[model samples]
Target: MESYKKTNKPRILNIVPISIGSGEVSLGPLYISSALKKAGFDSVVFFPDLSLIMHFPIKYDFIQHQLDYIMKQIRPEVVTFSVLSTNYNLSKSWAEYIKTNFNTTHIIFGGIHSMIEGENIIKLDYVDAVCLGEGEFSLPQYLELILNNKLTQENSLNITYKLKGKIINSKKEQVFLSLDEYPFPDREPLKYYYREGVLDSANFITGRGCPYNCFYCNAAMLNQNKGYLRFRSPGNVIDEIIEVKAKFELKKVIFSDETFTMNKNNLFKLLELYKSKVNLPFECQTRVEAINDDIAKELTNSGCESITLGIESGNEYIREKYLNRKMKNDQIIKAFHILKKYNIRTNSFNMIGLPGDTEKTIWEGIDLNIKAKVDSAACTIFMPFKKTPIFEWYQDKKLIIAEPNTNYYENIVIKHPNLSKLSLFFYSLNFNTLIKLESNKFKRMFKVFLWVKLFFLLFKGFLLKLIKNPLKLIAMNTFMKNYYGRLSVKGIIE
Candidate 1:
């Protein structure tokens, strides 16, 4: 283990663990790394691309070698991991491994998972600290104290740490009122590792925090004490986009906010600026209740290429009573119609196997997507997160089939009387198929063709599993070539 004396600047390594099926480059680590660099610290973002290492033995070895190499070479004073709920166990394992190998390095966990599970996470032997809400402000200050040997177990702002076998939580930190104060996220490190060509899009956030209280989400938990939502000025947001466009020559931008159309005034102002100054096509996600004719027109005029709306469940009872969405079916249908009228692509996000969901309700969801005529629709099985109200409800009812895991796409983790695991699996496949069928202009022929494709896809998956060694080698080669090749040509205007 390397020892560090007091130094002017300490090297910090920001690591993002790439879980299977999650390919997007997150902005949390990037923003935190940029903040640290601005405060005179040597910080670099490292993404161990494990997008393809779920079940492959050889790729597992490859990932271990890469982690060992980074720790040996970088020898960072502090190692931070940005984790999601699905990847919490994996992150914990990595933290344990790093502590065993590099005992001197301090370990900090920050992200959605750590924010909600702070008390339990801080008790872990390998974890030294957990940043509760936001890391941009808390992390730099915490690091400075460590460098100057001034850090104590006493309460600090927005940080929780352990000392003398007791956990000490800091005073609550205020949320940043102005988003313009922070520098643009450091994409230089992302450019080296992120597979930009996979989506051909760069992501930016116009704001932090959400005001809505969706039952299944953790946003309400984040806003419980800090009861405010903040947005960047329109001019400031455009300035960052201009800088990013010049640096990356990007084709598309993704406004990855909780709801991009939250503030009508701010949305219109930003749209006007984006129309005149940065005329690049962009996509965003918002709630169904937020869309209107005026908003839809402004979005289209500003080169909005696509829009995704969260129509979580089609059954009004399920949406309002269980999900707390408060959106009616008529509003969702109207929203989709408005987007279609403007010739903008529409995608609907739905969920199946929810707590109150039955076979009838699940089909209703599919029916709504079909009637909406969405260009694309995505359906994910509901996984009750730890801190959400729904998780507690399920626990009390003894409906939870197993602990939360990373398999949200293919597996069902809950046991509902009306919904079996096998039924849910087939429903997921059929839900997707129904959407594709509805999206097709030639519905009759394409429906038949799609079924054929689905059959072949299932057969191929089975064969791949049966011939494990040979198929695994082929799949690994293909994944590597596609991943690296796309990354090489990323951020280039076609």
Candidate 2:
């Protein structure tokens, strides 16, 4: 709240751009910062340890220590908190604390949860506004308008403004048209606190939104509505890689799009462009439906080192009836076979317990992973996210967040009634241990000196993990991204 005292000039802060959960950076605020800079306003994004502050079941008084330091030291006019699902309450509390302590700044909130749960959040005492949808474009304009004393816009897409304690009903905007319009991330402005490593080059996103909405999963985590599908042009995408390569001196990339190869033609074209221009290896997350012999070969030829498929369940009944994945076991086998045939590694993402998943179904999943011959497999305990179709289904079934003591994680895991909590958790952990011991890289590498091909392949195996074994995999990647491996724009080069 120390930054907004002046009504004439502009200052800005963006938070949660780097979600502590996965050590992932959200490009939303960075793009907004670029647009604000272009518009002649001083802007920068902030990456704080929200989890360090939130500190679920293992809460400590020290959680607020870092937040206290930020409030006392940093001075900015407008601060925006990117609120994810469980972060809303914690961030809102922080915003309120800032408002009460320092009156010079205005606090705002935005992100998927902010949009989906806009009304409840704005009802909070400290939140001045909620950027209801894509905030990158709308935020800059809103800030510019506020600075110019024209803070009332009725038709701007995706913003919920509060005027004098009354909420304004402004219309939302369409999803971004061109993903290529945004600027590249500059580590200098962020004070150089980022993940950079062999895996750091592994942390770039070329697109936003997903086309398909699977139940039992939070589709709204990326973007809601029919507008989740938006990607950059091949040239634009290659240019981003070149920017990172030239700036960070990296030789590989990780395409973090939900369905990295969702558009068949677009994937091929982008691969060809990368081969001709960047000549770097990369991996991506895709669905079983997108893989075929031709598509898999093109991916390999274009330097795709590996791919991860979200095989949520091996049981056909659960896939369609519960998760809405709608894929057949034959297609799943075919996809993994193609990846293996091309000598490109593969990862299978399996869910241990879901709404209708029986213990046998979960075992079928483990068996499915083995039969598919995936290079790696990840297992995750399903959580009922707020706005997913299945989330609502659970709520209707009167299965809300019953245990206030429960964190987003659990030593024992189960999403629904079929599998008991303790049983689910043990099975998930056991499956993970087996996958690790049986993993291709684990069985073949470490004792070998195949550092060349081993580098990318081994890294791919690790990248496809973490979703399941969060304690080890997530922590390792987080450290690898930031303090552990410091590529420094030099180490990534040959």
Candidate 3:
């Protein structure tokens, strides 16, 4: 690592999103990693084994080799753990293993999961600090402050020091709003993780947070109750997309933002910019309320060949009353029609058995999803996450059940007092199988291939166990669901 400011530059290492699909992603840590490097810190990245889903039943010994490779070659003075979802445990283990072997290396954990669960995470022996909320703005200045203070006797860095069993969360400053300011994601660098079989996938985040705070999600409250919906200028976004394509050989750039077409002016400008600069295929996740005829056509012209949408429930009552989603039933139908008119491959997400969910509502969702005839449909059971409206809903009703097992967290089926666990599971499974798979994308593109591959992979691993030991799977998923008495089974489709 090169020297900077007469002090040994902090050898910072970032762990990117470890999901088992595509290399060269630019979500949270990857963006922050780019920022840290631009700020002249010696930073390298390590992305753990990517799976289509979060986990597979395999003991990970290769992670040690990768960690050792980073430690020995880069010799980072500070090692940061980027924890997303339950993947924190894997990062925690690596952090502990690294620190155990080398006591001098400092460890800090950052990401949505850590930020929300910091109170629990900081107690672990390996972790030193948790960067709350966004880190591109917080991390750069945080490094400088800690270096100047040099609290050698203190136990923590960046965040409020945890001492004498008293803990404090770092006062978060501001989230970086300027997408132009962020360095182009290191596409070629990240491709090293899985370069050859790379499926020409690129993910870009144009905005953060959601406008409607739903009962089942965390992204809404992830902003700490600040008004939702923040975005970047069109010029900055276009530049980044072009940069990603040129450097990474990207065939499709997916805008992984919550609502890609929220602001009419910015979205139109972005669509125009994308049309002018690149003729690459792309996809995005959006709400039905946001996409009208004009916007759908604009998106299509800009090479939007595929899109994924969240149609949580077909029951209008659940959508409006329970989910905080304000879209009208006709609007959703109209939105699908517009996409279909544009000849775009559409994937609408559906959920079944939300609270007050009768068999009628589940059938409604199935009917709607089947009627839409989207390119694909994704489904999952609702899980109560901390800091969300739904979490409190469960807590208030005294319906909160604690499940010590990790498998339950996957939320395949809603656990409710009114619905038997087996009933919920079978309802979801049958509904999923009902969505007729046309395999249209196989003829049009290969997304269907990936989809099919992921389907079999799930059944091979988790589903296999569920088939053999249905009770175990139900127990695990139900416990992790954290459903209140007669918890509703809400679903998202993006």
Candidate 4:
């Protein structure tokens, strides 16, 4: 491959790898693309149409055909991938395919997977560079150097690039002290795929980084030595919301922060400003320990339709001892009650397949949700992602049954002494059934019929997998959308 002289404006394409049923939009590529556009570059975001290939095996030329189409249409000189661990292999394969076929395009990988696995990622022949940590500043600077023909060195801040078969790690980039300095995310590229009636909600992040270090989380690993928490100004957040409201005609907004209510002073100030300026119904995820009467009242007063709490496990011992979530069951119940008192809906997130979990413990989780009377609940099998403390524990204990796959809802990746994979599957359905039974207001006879109907639906779902029917894919997608919508507190504000 030969280097081409810098053009007046470089064409860049950002790719986001999403699975078939993933209906939500991603912000990483949008942010990076926004920064690129702000720097006066031609940038477009591309989400590969994975609907056809998701359930089937990819032929050798399948990716080639897709890449050829995109290359001809966009003629991008720089290609960047925002990938998660689940889609890392897919992104790598695409990058390798591009390197083999294209002559002038440069490949860059970023996101959680690349940030944690940069050393191994840069070793790949297809990966030209990896952006570490946040790319809001690092990516723009890298592109500026390329546009000016000044990126001749092997290393620079917040970037790891390959040169002469040698990998070089750049100096770490300074974290942005405040998030308000950046422009709003470039959602224009997403407008290409935005369906009219499906997913009318817009998502924005008011803050970055997490204050708590749960064993299953990657926040601590990603923000080591860097500041643990950084927030945008209230005025800036409200300004973005106002812009999105006018542009997208958004029905609702979702604050996709790890813990939206982490800082009480900031939270109160933002809520006050939001009530006066935007006043749109919004939802947020927060810690169980962070909620109180005052906070819940303020959230409702500020137009918060719903709140999501991470009651990861029901057993206090398991939650605190194993998962490092220090919230007690009483606190979880109290939080739900407080939200209920304020007429705010509540959603609880639970996890079942953990190292020390048994059938009893899993049932206890369901019991906790039922007792809390949450509007909806979601339970997922535990996945030990690479670089997380839980993954380290699984590796040391030799309990890992398989590599972490892209599917977290339907797959079990660890071997428990007492829990079989089949048992886990059945237990997940049981949890769903319990949540429905607890949430709905139906007669006793209808409830029994509903239970039977749900059981058959689960059984049919299993059979669909065996036959590899396309209807199974549709059913799974529908099931996921409904499940997430229910857990999102859909009707609370409406």
Which candidate do you rate higher for TM-score, 2 or 3? 2
Evaluation by TM-score, superior candidate among 2 and 4: 4
**Per-residue CA lDDT of candidate 1, range 221-248, in tens?**
8777664478889999999989888777
In lDDT terms, how accurate is model 3?
0.65
Model 1 misplaced regions, further than 4 Å? 1-8, 19-22, 49-60, 173-175, 193-199, 438-494
Task: Give lDDT for model 1.
Answer: 0.77
Estimate the overall C-alpha local distance difference test score of candidate 4: 0.76
Sliding window of 10 residues with minimal summed lDDT for model 4: 49-58
**Model 3 lDDT, residue 363, Cα:** 66
User: lDDT of each prediction vs. the true structure?
Assistant: 0.77, 0.66, 0.65, 0.76
lDDT tens digits, residue span 294-373, model 2: 88889889888978898888898978987888888888888898899999999877776577788668767876787788
Query: What's the lDDT for candidate 2?
Result: 0.66
- lDDT by residue for model 4 (1-494), tens: 01223356888978876542233567888888888889888887775543223424534365456556777677788899997877776788788877888857889999988888888898988888898867878888887776576775654668888666777788564556568888899988545334444347888888888877888886667567466378888889989989887877677888988689888998999999989988789899899888999999899999999888988888889888778988788888988988999999898888878868997788678878978888877777787878888888888989898866556676778887677776665566457665665456456457457657765756664664636756554554555455445434644211
How high a TM-score does candidate 2 get? 0.78
TM-score for each prediction? 0.86, 0.78, 0.78, 0.85
Best by lDDT: 1
Worst 10 residues of 2 by lDDT: 483-492
How do all the candidates rank in terms of lDDT, highest first? 1, 4, 2, 3
The model with the greater TM-score, 1 or 4, is 1
